[model samples]
Target: MEKKPSRSTEDRGISRARFLAGAAALGLAGAALPATGAQAAADTRTGRPGRGLTRRGVVYTVGAGETPGTAWDPARMRADIRAVRRDLHADTVDVTGDGVERLTATAAEAAERGLHVWLQPTLGDAPQREILEHLAECGRFAERLRRHGASVELSVGCEFWLFVPGIVPGETAQERIENLQTGTADPEQVQRRLTAFTARAAAVGRSVFDGRLSYAAAQDDEVDWTLFDVVGIDYYSYHQDPADYVRELRRYLRWGKPLAITEFGTCTYAGAPQAGGMGWSVVDYDKDPPEIKGGLVRSEHTQAAYLTDLLAVFESMGLYAAMAFEFLTADAPHLADDPLHDLDMASYAITKPVRDRPGDPASPWHWEPKEAFHALSRRYARAAC
Candidate 1:
């Protein structure tokens, strides 16, 4: 897999200290609890107290079988989904992957566990027709789940500009990203293509799915939210004031639709929080077994703080849903004894999958929760009640 370019504050030409200072000047709270609680009392959108973040969830990925640690086993998928509800205290689960069957089955398992299902099919680097077909099939399954009393929503696609081919004249996601960065790809043309494709996706989803429709847009992707029921964005905050998120996200409110932070969370490393969405790029995948680039320090505390801080922001804004980027990256296992090989430091998962321990006699895989897991459990437990 190619390294995703970082969307850090520095990348956006904003100095961290300057942005922080500006945010403080704007009276944004630096603390997690107090300011958010106060903001929740009066939603900026309505000038009244709004229901803040009704759905708390995590992204659960079931990779295609091409990978070694794909969640292909039905029993294991069930157990993982059960943990999302029982252990994490999340009310929703965003099931994302490429395989139509795997995505449907895992979403069903989450629904069975009484978790709201956000069926997101990510068919990266595939033909447009194939991607639409995958989404159509998933949509059909989602409608069935909804008819069966499951709370389900179908996200037709995510980051389609990079994932879907011919959008920006690149063969791969990385190349397309680079092309956009270097000015080789025209932004207006990309938006035109993205707009057309998103309309088609929404039409296909509406054709087969009767439930609410959404799309997990890339942080910078321009989307026509009027086509969908929910305004969802994969928001990743760099070293900016929480108030910055409110100011920027407030624009989406113009559509008068509920907003969802579809993807947010940082890797477990000292500086990972500052890296934001591109934190995972720390891994050098060119090697046979990918290894963490040198000099990065592992810090579970940083990851925990990053998540709660963002949750506070979302709560203050009275967002509808906030799904952490992931539950676990099975392929990125933790090697406690080997710093260079500790891939978990690059994963956004709250659970740390053991390197040598795939599972015990009772299960096919095993993982231990990081500090973020406990922090999220406490917050979600309180919010759900």
Candidate 2:
């Protein structure tokens, strides 16, 4: 399988001084208690504090089967949610993937576990002519999940200029990624096309789905929030100043709608946090058989610390909701003890998994929990207390 290019919008590599500065900024007190899930704190479209609502959740990446060559197992998925609720103590889940069946099943189980659901069904490299076909699938999924009586928020799509076909100068996201990496794509045209499609998506989305709506945008655009409910941004930290990441983010809150960090997470490696979104790829995908770069070391701590600091930032800013980029990337599994074959070194999952092996017999999960898992559990559990 051809490895896709990086999803990061900027080079997130940070200085050691900055990392230490962030660590200092976050003292023990930040982790001692839960973030102010204040009833008076804003958590809705109007920016008014909803009664007891701070969307604490993880992005449940659709189904277990979807993870590279890992056999599809619905049983494993249900078991995973049980752990998400029990271990992470998350109250919300942004379920994302391709199939309608996978999206609904995950949402249904999450709801049963007493968690709010955010359904994001993708159109995946669909052509300009297939926009309607894309929305139809989304409409069907959103409307059905709405009927389930779950506290659900439907995200129309994410980073459309890159993911959706023919929206940008390139034909596919792979092409657009190349154009973006090389700085050849037209920014103004990308913005115009994105906002235009967004308006149409919001209007059509409102007609089919009888509930609140949102879109996980890439770069900022003039979205017709008048047509939708909440403002969702797929923002990540990759800038020099810690304040800059927040500075760019604060602009979105001005929309006067409840905002969500639709996606965020650091990969597991020694320098992953410092590298930000670009950190996890220690392997050179350019090779025929991708190999983990020599000298790169794995450190669950880097991943954990980054998540802790960012979550604290989110809590301090009083953001309504956020979901880690994913729960697990089973396809990016551990390839024996060799650093070159360590696939987990390339993933963002809080749980480290081995691809071509049976899971641990002692544990119900196929993968072992990384340090980030414990850190996440403490953060969410402390908040609840």
What are the TM-scores, per candidate, against the unseen true structure?
0.84, 0.79
Tens-digit per-residue lDDT, 1-385, candidate 2: 1235322211322211122222222220011112233332222212332233288778877533422345446888898899899988888888876666676777788878888888876655556547655566767676776786768877887656655665566665555555654568677876688778877777777777888888876444456667668888654454433344455567778779998888777777776655544544465656545567767788789888777666766675678898876687765666556777676876778888754443331223257788888898888887787
Give candidate 2's TM-score: 0.79
The residue ranges of model 2 lying beyond 4 angstroms of the native Cα positions read 1-53, 63-68, 129-131, 182-184, 219-222, 238-245, 355-365
Separately for all candidates shown, the number of backbone clashes (residues 3 or more apart, or on different chains) is 1, 2
- Write one digit per residue (lDDT tens) for candidate 1, span 5-47: 2232222222211222222222221222222233533343232
Candidate 2 has an lDDT of 0.64
